[model samples]
Target chain A: MMLNLFHLTVLSFISSLKEETLPVAEFVNKSVKWITEKFSWFFDPIKNDFGDKLEDFADMLAEIPPSIVIVLVVLIAFFITGKKFGLATFSLVGLLFIYNQQLWEELMLTFTLVLVASLISVIVGIPVGILMSKSNLAENIIKPILDFMQTMPAFVYLIPAVAFFGIGMVPGVFASFIFATPPVVRFTNLGIRQVSKELVEASDAFGTTGSQKLFKVELPMAKTTIMAGVNQTVMLSLSMVVIASMIGAPGLGREVLSALQRANAGTGFVAGLGIVILAIIIDRITQNLNKESA
Target chain B: MPVIKVNNLSKIFGKKTKEAQKLLDEGLKKEEILEKTGCTVGVNRASFEVEEGEVFVIMGLSGSGKSTLVRLLNRLIEPTEGDVEIDNENLAKMNKDDLRKVRREKMSMVFQKFALFPFKTVLENTEFGLEVQGINKEERSKKAKEALELVGLGSFIEQYPSQLSGGMQQRVGLARALANDPEVLLMDEAFSALDPLIRKDMQDELLDLQEKMQKTIIFITHDLDEALRIGDRIALMKDGSIVQIGSPEEILINPANDYVEKFVEDVDRSKVLTAENIMKRPETVDIDKHGPRVALERIREQGLSSIYVVDRSRNLKGYVTADDVSDAKKQEKKDLKEILRTDMPTVEKDTSIQEIFDIIHDASVPVAVVEDGKLRGIIVRGAVIAALANGNEVNGDDA
Candidate 1:
């Protein structure tokens, strides 16, 4: 009862603002409508005609048996992270296959999206992290933006992304990018900042220039934390794939959403299985990369 | 000409605020802010000159600003007021490019932590400074290898800093600094972090390196023993100002005040005092090395407290006191090392007098300063007592 009262109070407050602040509220409302209309034409094609293209992108990837790729990836994990990790890699894949709905094509699209997003995340995230760590002003300005980007609801991110680029793999890629980037930036900053003060001073004492200090001391010390952030980014990006399908994004998210709409439990279960497999594959690869670096 | 000169240098931190920044920018004195806000004076109106190829030490306790003073010389921290002239160039006003160039070409430093890069192997850490100067990677590798060899880390080039002991890590740190071949090396308590035995070895290694490299070093440490052993001249600092600057001998013999005297009071003089403190003129030494009974007869007849021993080259060998001869009287044949207590109160010729007292206290024997393992003269208890009292050479014979 108290919670309902509190919700009522908040809703009343918002409703009162519309009356008391008409012009300002109207301005916000019209601006949003105008933006939606201006961009509506561009999005019409993705809504109307892009389904076959996305389906084919999904299909092309789906033809490869996940078990083969899983085995290959497990071997690679062993090569990179050693035998102890390879066993975990194989076991995790087996669990995903048994538990998931097992639609291979949809899973492949999710896997490709995660791989591309994680790559972009690292490339962009590290430099920003280095810059923020080096400059106090940059850190102060960038921190709040990163906080907002990470904490806001995932669906809310889709709204702006759709408004800008419309609903398709492009918008899906972009939404996942926004959702996944915060951990990388935050961790990169943390890793660089946490480097030992004595070590940094020692480098300075040895007459190392600013650039050498960064490359030789700061970056290397920051590697463990930065890799952790990369792992989080991969996980976060994969999480967004299923959510992106709500707005006509192809692959496992679409299959799951469509199956749910029709109440077809078998279709939904199989698609969910594929998504799980894709998630496991990505998680293993990135986790192994981190261990190898370590 | 002096290789380095510092004049009227001071560093004032946090002098400006929102209300008073304009006044400071317009050349207000720091004292004027005493009524409003506060400021920390890191380096007071300090002045000193270091001659070429001298190991000039700045000794101070933590927060005394000796470290800050050295940093000021390199413009690592810019001075609020004054000039640092290194090889005749004013460092305070150097542009960034020039300052960077100067640091690259003329000054290297070793930190207490032995700041080896944990990410890179020892060889790579050594090469990093040279790499900053835009040297090619291959050249850097070769130079770094040579530097590692210099510091005796040649076999461990592939090892990361984590794999090495503290002493070995410091060696890599030293190698990195040496790789630059800077004319002036600044060490801020560089060996203070090592264990006692390692500290001693590092000190000896530093002295050997100084002998070979001929690099002028400005070493900072709170350990007076280290200062006495390694410094050609030492500047003792208290607070932000120098208390005394002199050779170790002058400091031990004539400490400027109660502060310097108290610092010297506990130093083991045996390690610090040299043969020069104890040796007499060679012609004045009337005893032979192994004549034995005759020298004992002379001691009884003359009522002497101690007798000096010298080699054919007129260098100090050791000294035998009246007590040692009497003790040796019962034995038929006595070698000098056995008769002399073997552990004689001895010092290097360059040891300070304060250190002499330290050695005297430890060995409980009369002091002798040695040159090439032979005696110069004997500074018996009376000689040191008289020197302490009269502040110079004593005129009285041993009682």
Candidate 2:
């Protein structure tokens, strides 16, 4: 009897709120059409300019000879983080291994994607975070939006991104950018908010202007935390590479995706191994930089 | 003229400050005003003048508005209602730029927490004010180094604040303020966070620096002893209002109410009352006057065992005991100088009564309160005991 009642209640509820009667798809389509038709000028320039820049950077990274790139990376690792010979050697060996696997160009493409996405994320995130830190109203409004962006499935964003940017590297970047921005923003806000009240009072007492206090005291002190956020953004960007490749973004992700479809276990293993090595190299370099700054 | 003058300064810490201020003007107490308007009165109609080169102390318990008053003096915390004039220029009317300029040029502050920028080296912190003033690097660095040396932190200039001890960090904080060469200094519980020994040392160091710098200073503290030890005059706050303002001795001898009396009840009067506060007029005979016979006559007339012997210019030569005077008279001594005992215990007018205990313990004659080479007054053992026993009732006759 109870089961029959439950079924009846469900039937009534479903009949009252029929899926076909809902205007969700129609509303979304109309909004999308209107945005594209009316505001294409606004978005198209950004999409074209940013997309071209990303592709150019990726091509540059890919065209560089493997040996020269390896030399540069090792020198950078050694010089920026003095006495890190072990890290430099590891980076060198890791790059050589990726080259041996014949995945050098794919690695470079993945590197470029992560670099560009992380750069965009940091550029946009810091000021937003600072705004969030400064105003409770901004923080309250932005927090849930950030949560929505972070929590929404990466694939769900990809659909809309492809609709706006078409299936290509730009849409892939747009998707990855949505997926990776929250950490930097959240961390920057947290870092600034966590500055000791006494220190802020001291700054005010010394007659520091608002901007001077931010640049001289707050930002410098919050550097480690903000860098941690940057590190997270980079990793998140890397994680989106495989997903981004489904939209024809070229990288180790493409290699892995093609290998998955072809059922080529060896190719998949090699591509996956290449990705891990690349991730390790980037992670170690950033972690070392953070430690040095600290 | 006073370097800093505050008139009717009040700060209410809530949105209903205007309402609370109205209640305050109508003579509502802090708690009553809070009940009426949900506003916490941080400072209530505080008014005081700080003379140039004076260490004017503001003292109260944790919530009594002492800190708020000091911050208001610098306009660090904007007052709800008041006029603060620094060197006769009204700070309340200054614009942002002018206020910043005043902060950089006329007034500097040291915090209780030492408020050193954690990321900055001691040298960098010391140079902060000068940097804000846009001084050239070479000149600012030279000035900063001098200030650091003045605070005895010259050696740790290269170290970050976290590397230093609390007291040392506070000294760096002081150096940071001093480096600005500000005409006035506001110290907010600057040594309250230190160990007792370190706090005493800092207090002494501040007094020493005060001697050399002679800047107008407004010092905030919760410790009464500290207020008495360092302040030229002290204003005691209670429930967001100043209840009393006087020198330490005046506060001790004549508290304004029962609250102040109870506040000072446990204080060691011997430490707070100085020779200047307790000294009395002394009977004396001039050394170059007549002879030992005259000295004997003066002692006998005063019914005293001994009399201080001063030259005609009132410069204390020494003292002569009645026995020595008689011995001189019997020997027919022509000069009273021969009988004068130059070894009598003497103290400066600024010396604390606690310091005179040992000097007065075995002395037959009263301790001469001297400033430079001349005698100002004398301190007797009985007077010290009377002042210590009943701090408020101490009168001129007892001293």
Candidate 3:
């Protein structure tokens, strides 16, 4: 009976992979048609009102010469991460000016959303990690769930998120969170588990209570690994931003996706550059913060 | 009076009675507990005591329950059946809170591995014990600084544990224990992990510390030399039970059992013996410094080849002999170095008897004398033989 079940499971898994490939091809096929329909909807009265409001805001931002603010932020980041990363950052931002794309506001919006999602992931992931460490049953049950969440594609995560929240910024946030949370949890667990047994015993010998050990010994030693986890989470969130834009998540992701649909390579390329610039800044800044803390 | 005592601390493992009995029936030693139960028994029905300020050493081979027995004292591991009384308090029945209070206030342990917190700075690791006692950060930091000074690592306070060498890290561990200033210090092979030279340095450091702050110490070691060097009373354990517990002198001259005798038989007993054991009594006449005939008569009267010379002030001058006086007469002017065997080894009055044989083997001399700078009296191999023959009964004349 076990052998028959194993054979059946293998056949089903192979079939699922073949079945999932069909939707990917179909998605590319209908791209042009979808873009035209999307363009017409943008001109509709209600949609036009929203687009005009956003356009006006972008125009106001354009008048301020964002290069000044970008420079200031870049300098502050440089102070945190050091000069090598700072100069690399300035060059990436300079590319945005060279491309002369009108999607700078969209880039900022995407950056904000990813930052928010990753911060929340870290805050929530740590407690779950501590709980898993404390209880064997919890660890056992969570292990398979965590493994599944990590192994599944971030795109697959979008379906359930969209089904629950529907298409908007909220669903985009939900998707980004699901995409980014696994590393935070995995690294936190590893960090806590890696603390020295001798240190643990020393603290115990000194009559350190449970909370004291967790705070004084366990948390401090786990800090480096947890920060590394945060690094991974940020990178993962950046990867999900463009995918999130399909659900009306306003950002460089949406700008790039729309440009791609119309085969506007110049526009798409510029938006893609903006995304890369944002990813690099966020990655460098958080990584430096972690290094300092460690 | 016994400040701490233990009784019948047997720890059996596995649920099967037949297996335990079968192993016992096969004449397995208590150390064979691991092979039978598949679980290690750290302490086996062991018992001993420490006086108010005694430096008691529990010496044994690895896995002989020395470390476990020390842990059992502080309730680090709960004893299976024994009652451990610490200063009239029943530790076996204390609740967790009370036990914590006891550890925080009365006792502290130094680990063999020097369990300093790797992430914390040396200052922070040293202050950890005080922090656990709920002292505020500023106050504990002050105390930790003081402790670092005590162990002579004051300048390395801000450095992390990884920055320090093994000896420095263990000094921090010792400072951590000392920071709390508990009444009882339990050292679980704390210096065993350092390099041999560093181990010697740490031992000297501990001896200096002990002189200033005489806390009751329960030190554990597998090294016999370390036991003899530091222990006020040494307990030699085999299988699980203590074969003997006494001063290093008593154990060397008269071991309580054949096992202890076999353990110390190959050891150099001269290094462990004190000068008092080898010194001649006041009734024994000293050989005259200038009379050749009289010195020879005194040597023959004492049935010894040599006799010690001393001034009327009772200060040792040097050892003299009938041959020394005759040689002095043959030569008009005598060289003091040739007349006297100033090369003879001497030891402190309280040195262990084992050191005597050790010095004699190395020196290949007939006798070594007990002295205070100059020779007081001679202790020939005959004295040691007489003491060994009489065993512990050699209480008066021999040693």
**TM-score comparison, 2 vs 3, better candidate:** 2
Tens-place lDDT digits, model 2, residues A185-232: 999999999998778877777778889889878998899999999999
Model 1's lDDT to the true fold?
0.76
The true-versus-predicted C-alpha distance at residue B224 of model 2, in Å, is 2.6
lDDT of 3 by residue, A168-287 (tens): 565676777777888888788888888887777777788888899899999898999989988999898888888998877778889889998999998888888888877767777788
Worst lDDT run of 10 residues, candidate 3 chain B, spans B282-291
TM-score of the A chain in candidate 2: the value is 0.91
Residue A169, candidate 1: how far off, in angstroms?
Answer: 1.7
Model 3 residue B198 CA deviation (Å) reads 2.3
Q: Which candidate number has the best DockQ? A: 2
Which is the winner by lDDT between candidate 2 and candidate 3?
A: 2
Candidate 2 lDDT = 0.88
TM-score of 2: 0.88
Which number leads on lDDT? 2
On a 0 to 100 scale, what is the lDDT of residue A112 in model 3? Answer: 64
* Model 1, position A44: C-alpha lDDT score: 59
RMSD of each: 8.4, 4.4, 9.0
Q: Write the per-residue lDDT of candidate 3 for residues B288-312, one digit (tens) a residue.
A: 3444455556677767656655545
